[model samples]
Target chain A: MKQFFIFVKKEFFHIWRDRRTLLILFGMPIMQVMIFGFALTNEVKNSKIGILDLSKDEATAKLSERISASQYFDLVENLKSSSDIDASFRKGDTKMVIIFPEHFRESLLHSNSVQVQLIADASDPNTATTLINYASAIINDYQDELMGETKLPYTITTQTRMLYNPQQKGAYNFVPGVMAMILMLVCTMMTSIAIVKEKETGTMEVLLVSPLKPIMVILAKAVPYLLLSIVNIISILLLSVYVLDVPIAGSLALLMFTSILFIITSLSLGLLISSFTASQQTAMLISLMGLFMPTLLFSGFMFPIENMPIPMQVISNLVPAKWYYYIVKSVMIKGLGIEAIWREVLILTGMTVFLLTVSIKKYNVRLA
Target chain B: MTDEKVITAKALTKKFADFIAVNAISFEVSKGEIFGFLGANGAGKTTAMRMLCGLSLPTSGEATVAGFDVYKESEKIKKNIGYMSQKFSLYEDLTVKENMRFYGGIYGLTEKRIKEKSQQVLADLHMEAEQNKLVKSLPLGWKQKLAFSVAIFHEPAIVFLDEPTGGVDPVTRREFWEMIYQAAQNGTTVFVTTHYMDEAEYCNRVSIMVDGRIEALDTPTNLKKQFNTASMDEVFLQLARKAVRQAD
Candidate 1:
């Protein structure tokens, strides 16, 4: 253990001496949180929404068809009943579910008006509001098309219901996203590169010639990165609270516990990558392409996992970042406790164990 | 040479899948002897040294280092041996003193011993004033010397040097040999590999390997007389000319 602490101290020196690593560890997290939170929050494209047409009328069909035809929305599901709308929203496949009242076309013809309820999952309020505006515009276009045919003017009213977050001040989505991204970058990418640098420089062989165990070498290497990631998490949280005006609505202890778990998971991934490649460049490229890309694309952060096809959704479950993002969203944004995110925590723990076992086994085989 | 043996190998071998890296070669070195391991490129000198240093496993061999078995007691062997590779293994980002302290700590030295010995080592290298400087700022010869010093800082029984003086100037190489001679004089067995036959003259006994087998083993003067040559270079060339394996 004395040796382990020495190894850990040496690792700190390596990181402290390199300015680029310091830049990535401290500078990038604040940049991502502030930039994505304040500046890049208003992008909505290819939103997959569900249609619950209670009327099943010609007007409802025409309106649903018009909404689907627009480039901004992809009609993923035809939700059967009112009950299924909650399931679709919880599954996150549907951003907004449009419900049409019964006899909409007949009511419009007889009464000259109809109510179309737009239930948007306001977990991400920016996307939710933008999608509602797009749907309302499509309905207005349909109303004008009807007015062109008939001499009388028809009216379509849209009642927008923002679910789960009616008056929330802590519903910023980028906090969790930036956390996942920065952890993966600092823990996974930097740790892998550091280990591979030893191999490339041949210091690893020299250390192996000593009395130090291989597991101890890596465990010591991982501790510094783990601490560095915690520093990064603190910075991101501070920026989100002060600059972005987002509050942590749940237990701070639980938030930190989950972040540390995710950090360990990322470090295990780094050890696995280091075992596969010898050169620093190859390790870095593998971490970027194999780990970072998948985390960014599948973590339900920048892009919705439900918007992807079925196979991609299955693959997303294998990424530890996906589960971490879910847990952070539950605790940070939804103000839910462990009861709401126990399964996600369990999955992250399982991924960390599996990665650590495989990487250690491979490292031993190489040395043996 | 002393009667006590520090290293002994009998039919030691290492095979990687279909390729035989180091086939059934054996030798023994007594304590306090400078043993030279000579080979051309791809001749398995490094591979054999790796197995003995516990950095790699021998496919089939009966070897002991410092009275510890190479197979089951490899970790014990590691504790008693120090190694420096062709690539300089010191942490270039660390200061000269920090590198020494770290190596000393990993070797299970006490805190007072680490501090005192590191200071002593710095003074011995005439680098006390430069102890706080990062290793990267030093010249190549100083870096090489510091790496060699760090390897044996804990005074292990046997120090393995794998081409430790591959690319230094002649003066620096002479100084490096002086360090090796001093270590051996202090009763630390030196097992080194190099292609420079001139450096081979400094070893008490030398073994020349070609294509995974030791082709010759003797004192440098005996090798010259046996090959009917005046210099150790001609003796090595006469034996290495019959090789078929290409340099890796």
Candidate 2:
């Protein structure tokens, strides 16, 4: 045990002396969390909109005022003629144009409806689609206010309540996803590169011939990374709570335990890669392509797993990050306990054990 | 030491899938003797050395290092032997004293012992002033010497050196040999492999490996006399000329 501490200390010295590695280990998590928290978001806000109110009536003016009052749209301009819509879009001043036809209130009062044409720039289809929804929602609210006590014959009014995130903040979704990603990157990628580096430098042979057990050598390599991964988890969690205001609804201890399990899973994966790779470059390539790419695309971080193809959904089950992301969301956002996340915890534990067993077997076979 | 054998092997071999890296070859090294394992670049000297050091396993044969079985008691063998790989294996980012402490700690040396041993090692190399410098800042010869010193820091029964003086100048090579002789004189058996034929003459006994087998195992003078050559270099060329395996 004392010798193991010595080995871990040596490993830390390797990390400490290399300024670039230190930067990557500490700086990458903060940068990734900030990027996912602030930049890469699905929520639509402050969309620039143009209103062409040809009706010039009380009801149309009230609708325009309600849309502008909502946080979703900035209400960039009010155009006189319909021809001005093209210029607004061309100047990038408005993302959506709302045209209210003349006699809008008279038509709604007598017949029951009026034509409110919503034209949106489809150049960025996602933002355009979201903006159109926001505009329609604002107009619907305005109509509801206009219909004070008069109930429609058969109006299917739908009320949506964002369950976990009340305000529909993007940080709630990203905090967990970023945690999964940063843990995978720091533990799996960095550990594999460190082991392969020792092999490339011929130091692995010396370690192999030492009194230390092969298993202990592997543990010694992992211990420093494990500590660093914990530090990273803490940094990201602190950033999420303090900077991004993403809450941890479950027990913080349970969240940390799950993070530790995921980190070990990643470290075992790295050891497996290091067992087969002869150089640091090969280790890095395999970790990035085999681990990071799948974690990014298939882990349900940026995309929904259920929406994927059947084959992709099946493949996603094998990605540890996918399970970890779900677990993080359940614990931190959904406020679920161990009962809700036990299956994912088991799967991650199974992966860690499987990778560890396979890598140790590979190491032994190679040594023989 | 009364002809005590530190290493004993019979028909040791290593095969990589379809390829036989080390053919069944046998040799023995007495205590405190400088046993030279001379071969061309890919003559399987390293493969054979790795097996003896417990870093590799023999496919089919019986071998013992420091009186431990190569197959089952490899852990015991590991504790009793020191190895210096072909590439000087020291952490470039770590200072000389730090590398010493790391190696010593891994080999189960006590903290006080590591400190004393490190000071002694630095003093012997006349590097006491530079003990805090990173290994990358040192010259190649100095790094090589430091690597050798660290390899034997645990004072193991057998010290294995694989191409220890490959790229150093002649003077440095001679000085490195003097260190080897000093170690051998202190009753530490030195098992070394090298491509330098000139180093073969300094060994108490030299084994010339061709392809994957040791073609000749004798003193340098005897080898030259038997091959009817004036130097060990010509003797090696004559033997390597009839080799079948290409240098891998």
- List A-chain TM-scores for all predictions: 0.69, 0.74
TM-score of each: 0.81, 0.85
Score candidate 1 by lDDT: 0.90
The digit string of per-residue lDDT tens for model 2 on A144-185 reads 766775764222132332222233322237788888888898
Cα lDDT of model 1 by residue, A82-191, tens digit:
99988998896778899998899999999999999999878776677768878999999889888889978799999889887674233337789889988998899898
Worst 10 residues of 1 chain A by lDDT: A165-174
The TM-score of predicted model 1 comes to 0.81
Checking candidate 1 for backbone clashes, the offending pairs are: none
Could you give candidate 1's per-residue lDDT for residues B1-248 as a string of tens digits?
A: 68799999999999999888898999999999999999889988888998999878899979999999989999899999999999989999999989998999999999999998888888888998899999999999999999988999999999999999978999999999999999999999999999888999999999999999999999999999999999999988987887889889
Please give the distance, in angstroms, between residue B97's alpha carbon in candidate 1 and its true position after superposition.
0.6
Where model 2 places Cα greater than 4 Å from the true spot, the runs are: A40-45, A48-172, B16-19
**Which one wins on TM-score?**
2
